[model samples]
Target: MIFDFNKTTDISGWRVVDDGVMGGRSQGSFALNANGNGVFSGTVSLENNGGFSSVRYQTDQMALGSYSKFVLKLKGDGKSYQFRVRSSFRERFSYIGKFETTGKKQTIEIPFATMYPAFRGRTLDLDNYNGETLVEIAFLIGNKKAENFKLEIVSIAVE
Candidate 1:
């Protein structure tokens, strides 16, 4: 188990990052809900050329040589999101995997071999994730338009 959101889970390390960092007007927030789930919800504004919002967690570097995929148990507002990971916090790019969520609760699997390197919104030429070590994980919504989104996460694990 990488992270399991429950009534006693400490979520202070989770942070919201919006397009505001690059002069965009997006806003995002993260918190634990009454049902003991982690909720990432916010508005994605296109003002100032900003249309993305994200929540990220930085964790201790973990060796994942034996893990081939990441599993997420979540419920979304029928939107698409990107699940991202950084092999190292110092790296400028993240390995990203896109997923679409239904309004119902579901489990989504992301294979490390399919996560491609990307910086900002552009994909890089580097190879996919090597599944060596992971230091950061994030969820981002950037459909290039203004909208509101909410994603409730029960847990995240590696398999």
Candidate 2:
């Protein structure tokens, strides 16, 4: 099943989870655009050790073990962003896949086998993402170049 933004009128569980949780100055916001797309936009500040802003969605655990890839329909500023998925919500780390945007709309496919497990800012040498169930998903931008950024997401699907 796909998470279709166009068909969703209320993005109730989506929330901005920025560096502020760690006393950073970065700020971000998540909202639904008029086109019913998910919009994540905000400024990433370097003040107080802040360097990233993100938005996350928590959903019922989904068994994605059968899927080999994740597809995202999005438009973003010309920059790189991380797509993260977590099997356990209590874990401080997540499996991350980094992709660069082209400043235009596109469908990007990320192979599940390529995503690496990371904690804080360091990549763990543990096994790659092989989670059977996913409880959370997030998008984060932290190029370390501090700038205002925007990303519009239309849909996310597993295949």
- The top-ranked prediction according to TM-score is 1
Q: Per-residue CA lDDT of candidate 2, range 20-129, in tens? A: 98888888998888899999999999888889998988898889878988899999999899999998878779999999999999899989899999998899988888
Clash count, predicted structure 2: 0
Alpha-carbon TM-score of each model against the true structure: 0.99, 0.95
Off by over 4 Å in 2: none
RMSD of each: 0.6, 1.2
Q: Rate residue 101 of model 2 by lDDT.
A: 94
Could you tell me the lDDT of residue 6 within candidate 2? Answer: 72
User: Model 1 segments beyond 4 Å from truth?
Assistant: none
- Give the lDDT of residue 107 in candidate 2: 94
Encode model 1's per-residue lDDT on 1-159: one tens digit a residue: 999999999999999999999999999999999999999999999999899999999999999999999999999999999999999878889999999999999999999999999998899999999999999999999998899999999999999
**Candidate lDDT values, in order:** 0.96, 0.89
